[model samples]
Target: MTSDPQQDWQRWHERRTAQVSAPHGPLSLTGTYWLADHPDGHIPGVPGVWREEGDAVVLTATTEDGITVDGKPLTGDVRLGADHTPIPESRVATGDRRLVVLRREGLWAVRDFDPEAPTRHVFTGIEATPYDPRWVLPGTFRPYEEPHSVRVENADGRERGLGLSGELAFMLEGAEHTLQVAVEADGSLWAVFADATSGHGSYRFRFLRPAAPAADGSVTVDFNRALLPPCAFAAHFICPLPPPGNTLPFAVAAGERNVLAG
Candidate 1:
């Protein structure tokens, strides 16, 4: 690894911009159609009839409607489970658009991803502060006695469960702070947080993903790698808000601030 933190941060920022502006990235999301809101199985701008049946979503489409499933034209009904694959690999397609099925808290929704989405077409870049070493600090992870779930509001204005597995404690500006975090599948710790810069000098909230703690629970809290949540790029994403106690009282002037003006 490079000893220069600024170099590393620049590389990270470059990769983030590439990912965000990719054809099937968050910027490509054009719509999130909740099945319950359309009882008749008809979604605006979508060609198929989608209905929630038990634990799966059934999509009925005829070839004349021009919908394809798994790369072949669809002429009958298909039962689709949640789209666990990547956006480009989603089974349902209409020309260059992908239909991703998802379930959250027993609610079924279909997300439409189009390569030609206006947001993606006009994406400028991410606004961020140059990396400063001062934002890096030593930390310790303390796992909860048991996993806990908290009810939090999502970006879409709905409440949902936010699972937390541990607390990350660190010292900044001579005071100790703690943030609730979730353990990702890869063992990293993910935290949603907002500081004094939120909604003023920075995005309303940002995410910090720290490497897994060592055997002694030692880790690094690096705010220079903070990220804008998915909702910052697209309105259709239902990203969860920062959980209680995760908000820092100080201004975090590093990392990404917002999407650059397009």
Candidate 2:
């Protein structure tokens, strides 16, 4: 665990690059179809007929649809309870495309991913700043008196509820800053923010996830891994915008700056 930080950072960067370029990665996302938008449950170019079925999405298909469920051709009807399984194990497919069922805030949706997406074909690489220890600093997590939710705009120009469980407060340049944070299922702290650099030198908004808080409700707020939201990769993702008070007055000069196109 004791290797050069620069080398570790380089490896992390390499891994991030590989992850983004992998099949069904961010670039492969072609569409995120909300069920409410398509009452017929037929997503454009997606095989089969999907309809909401009480806490699940029901699929009806035929061999001519060329759809597969668990590597077997699908026909008739199969009640899918939202691809609760990992993406790799999602039950519906067409050729190399994965049809992932989803439920968000009680609304159902489907995500379509194809390895041959145009975005994936033309992607150059993610432009990331080299990691510096200074960009990583200690911070404290203070939970709210009670959980609160705020309506924030999404990358898709839609407003949705962004849940907040606490605040991560830290000092970057002799100035204390705070960001509303969500406690991930895995216990990590995730923040969505924007700054002076946004919309000019960097993506309009980015995400930062500090490591999980320690027993003392403290954590390390690392901006080196700040990320462009998935919508930055494709236009279909509904990534949430920054919550209130999460925008630091100071510029954050680290992490992926912008999308690089060929």
Q: Considering every candidate listed, which one attains the maximal lDDT? A: 1
Residue 182 lDDT in candidate 2: 93
Q: Residue by residue across 203-230, what tens digits does model 2's lDDT show?
A: 8899988889999998988888888888
Pairs that collide in candidate 1 are: none
lDDT of 1 by residue, 211-255 (tens): 999999999999999999999999899889999999999999888
Error of 1 at 34 (Å): 0.9
lDDT against the true structure, each candidate: 0.93, 0.86
lDDT of candidate 1 at residue 247, scale 0 to 100: 92
**Cα displacement (Å) at residue 124, model 2:** 1.1
Q: What is the TM-score of each candidate against the true structure?
A: 0.98, 0.96
Worst 10 residues of 1 by lDDT: 1-10
Give the Å shift of residue 153 in candidate 2: 1.1
Indicate the residue-level lDDT of 226 in model 1.
Answer: 92
Maximum-TM-score candidate: 1
User: What range of 10 consecutive residues in model 2 has the weakest lDDT sum?
Assistant: 81-90
